[model samples]
Target chain A: MDTKIKTNNTTSEKIHSSENIDEQMLERLFRQFSQEIPDDGFTDRVMKSIAAVSQEESVSQKTAFSLKAQIPLLKSLNWFTAILSVAIFLFAGGPQLVWNSVFAPIFSNVTSILPVSVFRWTFDDWLVAFFRQAHQLYSIDVLTTPLPTIYILLAVLTALAARRLALLTV
Target chain B: MPSVTDIALVLQVVTIGSQRAFATLVERHQEPVRRFLRSLTNGDEALADDLAQETFIRAWQGLRSFRGSASFRTWVMRIAYHTFLDEVRKSKPTETLDSNQRIEPNATQTDNFMLRHDVQQALDSLSEIERTCITLQLIEGQSIADIATISGLPQNTVKSHLMRGKQHLTTYLRNHGYKD
Candidate 1:
């Protein structure tokens, strides 16, 4: 009976010791395996690649932002708002004829009032040259005849047709 | 806290187009990323290095989008994991192991080499997801939340994967005559 008890205790202790050994073995194995990884300029190569990529992206983003900034309409919220307000006025007024008539005159007046040095010519000189050139190029009646009205009417009709077609397809 | 501040400074420098800052970030994270990728790829050092490079490249491209919601390490690890998975998917399907074949030894007899070989072979036999879970949890020593973030899985799913991986490893070890 004592022998049987001793055998069972020995077996249990052996099993316990074996478990401990295995755990230790696993820990050691992990350490050795980790040490096998090469640190040979791997990080340096990665950093070089990252630096190249970052430089490329930064250049592209700066270029894009600078381009966007150069556009007066996109440079400031106030400019966008002003343009949007003008668009809203054009849309709400419902006088397509008035828009066509007023557009050229407003543009002409604004350009005329700006400093003559902007064009490298006096305003009067530019106006005289422009009208003289126009007279030399075409009949006065033909130059004065408005074409944007017809173009705008065609654009509106084409857009409505496109919308209808898109809706039908959907 | 110092590391956090350093990362923040590097981020600021990166934002202002500092190549040095980007290099610093890559240098700092490369080891962890390589370690994680090595485990995921089953000790393929070359593949891990390639994937690590790709991760840094992707991170550089997407740096502007990082919102500081998670640690940069977690974010970069997540990128590396996805890049690895993408490569895995694009490559041929993973070779399936025969159930009847015995696990092969990978290390020598000297100085616990057998133990290392057995552990590595057992790890190789596990499914990719299982390997990733085990690597993140045991090898990389990432927290559960960080593992979830890196694995892009829910926390519960990550836990399940870790549990299943451990169970599989235990069975493999026992079958290989390991007593633990």
Candidate 2:
């Protein structure tokens, strides 16, 4: 009821039913433009939309916060996958290729300080078995070379898939 | 009396995401903003209300930037004015001359329907600037300075637009047998 069209209502009231039309009538008619054009629930509609927007804002914000909370775990998983791939490649006869240039001193120190038994039944043992299996496969002329690059490629592809899956779901 | 302080208090509440305060502002100001847009839209109520809704949404987004240099109503009206201008500008490049700019000779009805339709036709006949100036001045009862503030035109230019717009409407009404 806020936007009552004061123009048509008030105009006929203020102007006598005289046949003569003056500039005053014109002014009055124009003044009708200023009259409230009765909203008929327009405000309610606007307020409803406002409330909907506020609700949507809160909901989306909560969703975003939840998404942010998932990020650290996703990142850790990504790092784990990347590290596992690197570790597998390193132990699978790829270390000799990098032994002198990269891993010689670090390997020597690690072997000296760590007992051989400590590496059993863990990822280290898995790495050694994986290399042994790969070496046997290569020795039979299945691969004329020690192909640690394949395991490295697999590791990278695994990390990439994990990264993509994380992104897609979240 | 909706005092300035009360309005300012509501505005402050709105800044903190108070829906009630924002609704209060909308209830208080929606009439004038919608009417102003109605005039701009040539009585296209739906278009006018859409613009009004957009104006309010923009106001809500940018409420924090309101420096209170103008009355809150004036501030909203100014946004309404620019919103109309922006809509017009965006559509201008694609607009063809309204194919039927001339009125039908058969505008002979004396009922409220015809009067309202005739008024809409008269409003649509004016140039956009003239219609804007006349609407702000005559319909909305705003002073020339306030019209300048809302429409972002110089006071003298606003006056000239008002004069020319009124003259055109006078002629249009006279020809239509709407009391001279």
Q: What lDDT score goes with residue B33 in model 2?
A: 94
Candidate lDDT values, in order: 0.67, 0.71
Local accuracy of candidate 1 as per-residue lDDT tens digits, A43-84: 678767766666787799999887666554333434335444
Whole-model alpha-carbon lDDT for candidate 1? 0.67
Best by TM-score: 1
Candidate 1 segments exceeding 4 Å error: A1-32, A36-38, A58-170, B1-6, B94-114
lDDT (Cα, tens digit) per residue for candidate 2, span A1-170 = 44467766754653442223245756767655355567688778887776777789889999988878898667666667666865576556564555554655565567677856433244434555666686687753323434465456546766677677877766
In terms of lDDT, the poorest run of 10 residues in model 1 chain B is: B94-103
Q: Residue B169 lDDT in model 1?
A: 74
Predictions' DockQ, in order? 0.15, 0.17
lDDT of 1 at B13: 59
